[model samples]
Target: MAPGLLDRSRTVAPPGWSRWLIPPAALSVHLSIGQAYAWSVFKPALESSLNLSGTASALPFQLGMVMLGLSAAFGGTLVERNGPRWAMTVSLLCFCSGFLLASLGAAVEQYWLVVFGYGFVGGIGLGIGYISPVSTLIKWFPDRPGMATGIAIMGFGGGALIASPWSAQMLESFGSDSGGVATAFLVHGLVYAVFMSLGVLLVRVPAEGWQPPGGKRPQEQQSRKPLVTTANVSARSAVRTPQFWLLWVVLCMNVTAGIGILEKAAPMIGDFFADTSTPVSAAAAAGFVALLSLANMGGRFLWSSTSDVIGRKNMYRCYLGVGGLMYLGIVLLGDSSKPLFIVCAMVIISFYGGGFATVPAYLKDLFGTYEVGAIHGRLLTAWSTAGVLGPLIVNWIADSQEAAGRSGAGLYGLALSIMIGLLAVGFVANELIRPVNPKHHLPEPASAAGQAEGTAGHEGGAEHKEATGR
Candidate 1:
């Protein structure tokens, strides 16, 4: 029988294929799944049509985020074993079908279906798709892992840019009622299904022993950087290391600091200027949120690429160290000057986005690429934890302040201070990271053919069996 279509062996790149094609393939799936960020666009319509409260309508988005972490953590090893082709196919089916199932739920007026379909089913797609391109791109462009992963991940941040307006316009044209919501969901499912198919068709794994043309080999590069290891660490070994948990704390703290502000951007801005000489209007507040989104998206690519030059450790120093200072600037001078406040907030948000884009390359530097994708999936548990922690801290503080008759910028002073502390903690954690122990490295194979077989086991199990006529 011919090889299966989604099998890892089937997706190997031809000799002399350009690696540049990989980013667009990764972008297709990322951009499609990034629609999760635009969940807010549907929240109002869901609340009004279903006659549910604000918090009730938020259940799907919150649950989706929770599941994104869970599925990525649990399914990461399967992704590595199966290859990007299999993983991407699984992602496409789950993500698109989620919308279709959710559309049906809305049409029948059963809210639970929407929650299950969109939150549970669709979130698996988000988790798997999110990490699908990470290892492939890293292996293809070991010369510039930071820039390569940055290019694909930037699409995730920008996805909200395309999705938010598109969703809003659809709701406007289709009338925002239960029927219109169903139609909108249906359209989203169909459109994304087609778009994500491009990724499945175009994605390919580098041929075994492939190296970038005219670039230093990964071993050569690792010789100069003490932190960059040549030995591979399995996903199981990675989590047990102190380095892994340290990076986890680094990611969690950085994400918490940034996401707290993001979750409350519009309202936070309005309150900051509520009693100023020129109070911010609703339109201006909305514009501020847009500007923050642009900053977030732009920073992912720019800062990650910069990490290629400055080194990952130094890049994170800027993220957590300078990020904390930015928060302090806002707390100290925000009320006195509007321009200063906006600029500071933008910088802080940019660092937040940068933290996400840069961490994969950092992981690759610390752990060899052997199981980096699975390691990445495991690392995303931090994102899930921060998702809840960040918002809870900010919202809880704001509520307490409000009860005590605080208003304006004063309402956020304590929250901003708390963010600074978190960044400090992250900065320390980043500093604590060191090289993994040799005890944890996968033992070196005795021969070249044996090494190739070992790699094939992780890259594509069937390839080795076929090569050996097993």
Candidate 2:
């Protein structure tokens, strides 16, 4: 009945309680980044059509990941200052451009173009897009940061589910040859641009006094430092802390352990059964990839939520310590049974996914949520480091083994052993984590004051319940 009510509703979130929309906005961006996981689908096509080696063809995906971490770390402060809309908008433009540019590279048979487009440009998008909604969501859903993050992150893990099948079909329809790969990349770029735009436009931050329903804390309540409070610990101060470097080591080790399998999933499976009675088929190997994706997605939610209960430090203990045991089982067993190998690999990969999902929450808990987005952006440097390290370790070990005429589980024994060692290192790093110091606290601003009361109250209740409750 109101003349402008319909148009007004569409323009912005209704004044009181529209922060609920932030999660969907986050999903839109994450779904697109999720496509990053599907890069393997293109690898075979690149190898076959361009006559490229697995390592050469992997450059774009690898570089893209590097860029993702680098850009996120380098540009975190900008995202914080500019707000999610601006950050997300850049992500849309760069990500789309990366795809479009890669399409051109594929069409012309210029590999570096794909490298520059997808790796550099699109990687930047991935980084910015990844962190854009993080602080915003944590702010909006202070009580259930884990769940809110899981809602969007689950889409990221699932993004590849949609992308892998869709891309494979596109490759099939487009003929899997060079031109088809070009078409696929082009379409993917354009389509994701459209998909991510919905997030940029629809996302809204909480107003000055807004709080999560039933989750508000009162002012004047003492609160522990948030791990993600960037204002207090600038990138300079953050890196200076023992905790930051320790986390870096922990994340890098965890990521490297997982990626050792991810980079060589197909060949690894194939190698495992190269001498078996019923060896892995091409289809079976592809199935393994899909299974890994499922584990990755499941782990993101499961492990992160587990951290909410078990505490971040202890949860990582399982990731690195028990994770080492899993790898040991895989190494000792030697793919003796496909089922055991698959189960072990899946569990390890899930922990990898969980590590990723939990890190943001870890940052939120340690640094405070004020500038969590920026702090997380900076911490992504660990991701960049692991991206390169993980693949390099796997591929290098595999390559070395191949050169030395090793195959199957024999080639990976060395790699898995290395992962076990690295995870042990991460365990030490996890142990080194401690509460952030008071020197990192930023003075509260007047604008933040309105929300501070409830924020502190909720935190106080949690601390009391956590520290002293029966």
- Candidate lDDT scores, in order, read 0.88, 0.78
lDDT of 1 by residue, 198-301 (tens): 99999888876877788666532644887787777778789999989999999999999999899899999899888888999999999999999999988899
TM-score of each: 0.95, 0.84
Model 2 TM-score (2 dp) = 0.84
**Reference-based lDDT, residue 111, model 1:** 93
Question: In model 1, which runs have C-alpha deviations exceeding 4 angstroms?
Answer: 219-223, 446-470
Worst 10 contiguous positions by lDDT, candidate 1? 446-455
Candidate 2 Cα outliers beyond 4 Å, as residue runs:
1-14, 43-56, 105-112, 176-181, 216-236, 273-278, 399-407, 446-470
Q: Give per-residue CA lDDT, model 2, range 1-470, as digits (tens).
A: 65332121232344665667888899999999889888988999988988899988888887888888888888886776556677788899999999999999999988889889998999999888888888777777766566667667777888888998899999999987779889999999999999999998887666546645665541112254333333333344566677777888898899989988888898889989899898999999989988998899899888877776566778899999988999998899958988999999999999998888888777776666655677787777887778778888888887898899987789999999999999999999888888778675444442243123223322332233345331
Model 2 lDDT-worst window of ten: 3-12
* Clash totals for all candidate models: 0, 15
Q: Candidate 2: what lDDT?
A: 0.78
List of clashing residue pairs for candidate 1: none
